[model samples]
Target: MKAIRIYEFGEPEVMRIVQVERPVPAPDEILVKVYAASVNPADYIIRRGGNEALKPLLKLPMGLGIDGAGIVEEVGSEVTEFKKGDRVYGVPNYLDGSYTEYLAAKATQFALMPRSLSFNEAGSLPACARMAYNGMVEKAKVQPGHRVLVHGAAGGIGSLAVQFAKAYGAYVIGTASAHNADFLKQLGADEVIDYNTQKFEHVVSDIDVVFNATPTTTVDEALRLRSVPVLNEGGIFVCTHGVWPSELFKGLLAKKKATVSMAGVDVNHHKIFTEVAKLIDLGKVKAVVNKVYPWERAAQAHHDSETKHVRGKIVLQIYQED
Candidate 1:
């Protein structure tokens, strides 16, 4: 087997492909022959040594990816949900890494890949789609006829959030650059606000649910604060990046009787993946792949992801699927 490993954290150059022994499945696990894996912002963050609190916990010579799609090569004695030749896609153990020729992890971490999608597309959905599903459906509780607003609506998570909101029959509004306005609409956004030219807070109001999918930054923090006032009374605001400053935003939220929630991806939630797979197969949702790189070019893929301008997910093809 071969895998992407980092001996020490610094630049993307730190990641290297190396020959490694194949792993055997545990009693409740499955071994997948990986075809494709997606690169995420977290990958670059881990490659850059992560933050201060996360630095010491990271071991050297670590694997680099979190999600992927592939065919099942083998299954454990106790695993009955999946068998040999099952086509699956989902999160792998973060420490074990998905940027490899083979991945051995608990069967519960995966679900059937959408039959309508290709390996590259399926590989791109696990992490981002789960985050979107958690925020819009589980946290915010979006419903039919609601007016939903999604920030960073052209990016990986936001794009899926728009589709999920539409699938639930919500009227969707998205914020992105002017170039992606049409793209957002094609994804079912009823309205598209160009964040570069017009401020979302001024243009849209009475939002039933506001989903903030932008990366955390000083500017985005301020934007989150501004978004709260636009929500209708009793509306929900879900932030995937992190929670805003409660002290500053509490008064505004109280005035509107709105609630704020922080969303996190649950990698072990097989049921959520199964439900989402149904949506994908039904054409209610689709994967947004920005680019696909050969697995050996993982360093280049990380460089592109760090730029923060990619409209969707960047994937690494480990093995060509027949």
Candidate 2:
């Protein structure tokens, strides 16, 4: 099998396609032939190295993808939900390193691919979709009448968050560049605020749930969201990026009580992925793939995702859908 492995962490070029032994499934796992994989912010972050805090989440010389779509090549004896020929899409594991020709992981982290989508579209769903689901549905528990605000609403995870919140029956407000206003509207957002020309805080108020999908690790940006006055009482602030627990809420929580949650904990849970698949199948949500690249050029894929201006997800076709 072939995979993108890095001997040392640095730039995208450090990742090279190398020959590696095929992985075998565990008792509760399945082995999937990689058809397509998606590039994410985490792929580039881990490649650059030295966020030692994430060492437990990532291993050196491991594969470089978070999720993918493929046909089930083999399954473990303990797995009953999938078969050898099943068409599946899912995160190979909760941690990083899924960029490869073959991957093995617990069967619970995957679900049947939506009939309406191709391998490339299904491959784009798992990681980002699950992350969005967890943030909006699980953590925030957004309700029907709630007003939801999605920051970075044009990016991969943010786009999905907007749709999920809308599906949950909330009035979705997305903040993006003016160019993406129509794109977000098509995804069911009731309102789109252009972050460049207009301030989101001034444009919208009393949000019940604020989905912050910006991929930043700093506390600097999170501080500006002192949304005490902008959010209703008990509003939920779901931050997908790394956050310093105490610094985010110095004076913001004094007046109104709000829960500040950092997502990505159970993002790869099997049940959530299954639900995401169902949403896609019902046309309640759609995958947004901005670019597609051959798996061999994964380095370039990483470069594009790192740019952070990509409208949606970037996919890598490891094997063409035939």
Candidate 3:
């Protein structure tokens, strides 16, 4: 089997395709023939050795993907939920990675792929869609007529967040570059604010939920702080990137009696994937795929993801799906 691996952490150039032995399913695992996988910010972050807390988990010559869509080739005796030849999609083990020809992981990590989507499209949904679902449905508890604001609305998780908020009957507002305003609207955003031309806090007020879907960075931290004043009384601010609110931002939330919440997709929960698949099949949600790269071009995909300007998810076609 061919897989993308990084022996040493550095640039995108550090990633390389290498031939390796295929994996066998364990007692509770399934072996999947991967069709496609999506590149995420976490992939690049891990490629660059990750943060101090994540560094200890690093093993040299590690694979580099989180989520993918595929056909099951075999299932272990304990895995009765899936059978051979079933189409499945979800997050594989972080250590195992999904950028490979074959993935063997716990069957509980996957669910049936959406019936209405292609392999590439379904491959893009697990990570971002789960995060969006967690933020909008679980943390923020979006309701009808609620004003929901999503930062970095053109990117992978943000795009999905907008759609999830809309699906829950919230009034969705998105902030992105001028180029993506129309795109955000197409994703069901009720309003799109051009972040380059205007500040979101100055234009939007009394927002019921402010979902910060941007990558965790110094600039994004500042942007997260700016959203504090927009929340309505007792509103929730959801952070999807693991960034906690600063003391100043916390003080502002205190005045409004609002609170900040952190959200992360629980890949082990198969029900989340099943619910997202339902939304996709019903036409209420769609994967926002920006580009598809061949498996050999995994390095280039990492480079594109590092730009942080991609409109949506970037996929790697592992095997051509007939």
Q: Which candidate is the best by lDDT?
A: 3
Q: Write the per-residue lDDT of candidate 2 for residues 157-275, one digit (tens) a residue.
A: 99999999988899999888899999999999999988779877777788898888866656335434544457788887787876445654635754577767777784547788778
Residue lDDT tens for model 3, 114-169: 99999999999898878888878987889898999999888999999999999889
- Candidate 3 at 198: error in angstroms? 0.6
Segments in model 2 whose C-alpha atoms lie over 4 Å from true places: 56-59, 94-96, 219-224, 247-251
lDDT of 1 by residue, 90-121 (tens): 88865688998998988888999999899999
The worst-scoring run of ten residues by lDDT in candidate 1 lies at 241-250
Would you list the C-alpha lDDT of every candidate in the order shown?
A: 0.88, 0.84, 0.89
Candidate 1, position 33, lDDT: 96
Worst lDDT run of 10 residues, candidate 2, spans 219-228
Pairs that collide, model 3:
none
After superposition, which runs of candidate 1 have C-alpha atoms over 4 Å from their true positions? 242-244, 265-268
